[model samples]
Target: MELISSDKRNQLFERFAHDAFHLELRDDYSVPNEVGPFEDWLNGRESDDSFMAPWLQLMKRVTESGKTVRRVRVVTEPHSPYIQWEHATTNVNEEAGELIRWLPRHKLPAGLHFPVDGNDWWLFDDKLLAVGHFDDGGRVLGSEIIDAPEIVAECIRVRDLLWSIATPTNEYQL
Candidate 1:
């Protein structure tokens, strides 16, 4: 299957109406742009978050127009270092109008099965899906765009189920 580059997938942000939701199941993401920031955070040094500027700007625009961006992060606790950093920084995303929630992996309902081969995905308006593909080193490859009715429907169901139980970022404690 053909996969679109992350840049291309992000363009969906410009087109999607209503809501865009992301499911993050990984404890670490080795995004190249994040390498410096992550390392700085790990070393207890001040870190610059300018790398997130573009995405934050986009989310700000999207939410300002009445569209919503949300994410459910299924994490394993005690949180990984990266997750801890993410938890600390999530307020920035929220400030840009993205609603984020966290759910411990152990808290997922029994028998719940993730769709799209258990890969992370972004669902737009409950109609389109951009399923993330990653290399073995935890780096992103790209995303496969899937709009098949059955697949999108399954993702929507999962999004709803997880969203219902996940704790809003503000209420979650380390």
Candidate 2:
């Protein structure tokens, strides 16, 4: 698996031709950069949007270009503190124009098929995938790029299925 760096991921985003869809399966993420802000949030601090500004700017630029940015997160209900933190901060992304939805884990159909790898990923233009890699502690390592049509197709099918049933952020609450 070839790992792509964060800078390269930005390049992929800039170069994607159409929509970008993300599937987030993890309930918790131990992102080093988010430690301080996450702690602040836990202590009842709110973003003046500074911590999330770069990503908000990126999402704004993408959507203003007439492209779509969407995400479907499969969350475990009675949410993890990390997920609660994410949910609270999601408004930044929404304000920047990314569409997000949530699917409670138990709501998914039993015996449903999943991509063989079953890793969280960003599917760009329904073609290329930036498959995520994480350490045991849930810190991101990086992403591996995959452009296989068969795999991308599976991801798209999963995305379509989840999007159809997932609750829009406004209606979802822990």
TM-scores of all candidate predictions against the true structure: 0.98, 0.95
Candidate 1: where are CA atoms >4 Å away? none
Candidate 1: lDDT over CA atoms?
A: 0.95
- The candidate that wins on lDDT is 1
The C-alpha stretches of model 2 lying farther than 4 A from their native spots are: none
lDDT of 1 at 25: 99
- Least accurate stretch of 10 residues (summed lDDT) in model 1? 29-38
Residue 165 in model 2: lDDT: 98
Listed per candidate, the RMSD to the true structure in angstroms reads 0.7, 1.2
Candidate 1 lDDT, 1-174, residue by residue in tens: 899998999899999989999999999986889989989989999889899999999999999999999999999999999899999889889999999999999999999999999999999998999999998989888999999999999999999999999999989998
Candidate 2: minimum summed lDDT over ten consecutive residues — where?
A: 46-55
> Residue 9 CA error for candidate 2 (Å)?
1.2
The clash count for each model shown is: 0, 0
